[model samples]
Target: MDDEAVIPISALQHYLYCPRQCALIHIEQLWAESQHTAEGRLLHDKADKPKMERRKGVRTVTAMPLAQPQLGITGVADVVEFHTGEDGVEHPYPVEYKRGRPKAYQADEVQLCAQALCLEHMLSCQIPEGALYYGETRRRTVVPFDTALRALTCETISATRAMTVSGRTPSATYSAKLCYNCSLFDLCQPRLLHRGESVQHWLHAQLKGE
Candidate 1:
């Protein structure tokens, strides 16, 4: 694949959350903002502003553009803190801001780890960990970029890239808990579509048996 074909790091998170959602957003360019999404956007907006600040021995840069050609993923980091070690070595720690509380899934962690991977590639340094700041709890949770997470991140990248290039939106699978809060709820109409498909399949089966 050409280096120019860069996939958004956000797609990895979206794909993990829901492949249909990812395809709808990236492939079809469909989007809607719900209260949750708006809150998340506001949180990201606050972090996305380009700025630099120093705190004690740590220097922080906000909205830093990060990309890894090998992974074909690109996105701006919310914050990259450069902490000076006792040995005078500087370590980069990426911190991502989220609107909601932590979830059972690895979507948020995968996103954070992808940022760390980008930092590793761009700076030619290894990052062992990063953090996710959740808006609901107003607390930062540290995440380790371990072997499992790294492997998952890579897999997500490849899967997301394939979905993006395929230009086909995956069919929606409805979940009341998830679809209710999704920004694209109305647009996706997961319940309606899935129900309609189910009915169609049932009718087809009846006709085939006749």
Candidate 2:
């Protein structure tokens, strides 16, 4: 992968969560850390710190560099736990730390899948699964290497590559649902762009000499 073109793994998940949010973040370069992001950052503060520790069943390495060049993605793994199997085979499971509970959306999945892909390429092993630890729930959610999610993750990577190459943020397609919690609502101006009868309002007024 091109060192300068290193893609943020979060962008893949962000696109899956909301294309508008993805565009606002990666395309328009607009962002603000709300309560959710702040909490998440605080959680990551500890994870980002350098560390190495051993537990009964596993060894933990924090701030590991993970990426999948074939998919054009890269990011830092929060933690990768080393486990030894019954057959004496060593396995690496990348664990992503999240600040909130699991969502119906695919954001977290996409991020985790990207990490799995990265680990696979890095280790030359088939990463069959990974896990997400949510701080709020204090539980680890295991994610299997299913075909559907992998496909979605690949599609997301391609879409993000296309977005960055296009170098143009898409116009806001007004939708109350998408704009509700978006950090870019004000900058995107979905309301201003789509309101008052659209372009027809201006054309009609001009033609009638109003």
Candidate 3:
């Protein structure tokens, strides 16, 4: 109500995938899932359990709380590891748990960056990099927090907050690419919608033809 936007960190991933999809889920609170999403749900459920462990002067925690008050976004990370650097200062490293292998999208990186930003804002620390752990491959990929990623993190945060403040969901744009394994495929009817046709009217017309 204060005209300040409070967006969730996940919106950054949605926005990267599709603006309309992002708005639908975030602003309209609409969601329809498929097998892929279900699997992801289970994977996150397994990873989100809070655990406190120690290794070599570092403490690791799961389902760690994070926030960037200036950005007005709050969320939790899969794992937040703390280590003492050579200077004897405690540093935080965020490791994101993924259900699948590497994706060809900035969406994952954006999410990780958001978490890092939150840590930076909250702890007043300089987190130059983080790592991603992929469940499928059982590997860790390190991501550098360079100028490019930082800029994207800042930009996505701005866009997501702007979207939430308006409180209007984005309209679905017809894209055949979005149909693969999409539970909303039938509801969305990307095939017909992409052709600039309405499935309801087309079906009605077909019935008359019969």
TM-score for every candidate vs. truth?
A: 0.90, 0.85, 0.84
Q: C-alpha displacement of 44 in model 1, angstroms?
A: 1.8
Candidate 1 error regions (>4 Å): 1-4, 194-210
- Please report, as a residue range, the 10-residue window in candidate 1 with the lowest summed lDDT: 194-203
Q: lDDT of candidate 3 vs native?
A: 0.79
Q: Candidate 1: TM-score?
A: 0.90
Judged by TM-score relative to the true structure, which candidate is superior, 2 or 3?
Answer: 2
lDDT of 2 at 156: 83
Q: After aligning candidate 3 to the native by TM-score, how far in Å is the CA of 6 from where it should be? A: 0.6
10 residues in a row with least lDDT, candidate 3: 191-200
Q: Number of backbone collisions per candidate, in order? A: 0, 0, 0
Ranking by TM-score: 1, 2, 3
Report the number of backbone clashes for model 2.
0
Q: What Cα-based lDDT does every candidate model obtain?
A: 0.87, 0.79, 0.79
User: Alpha carbon lDDT of residue 148, candidate 3?
Assistant: 99
TM-score of decoy 2 = 0.85
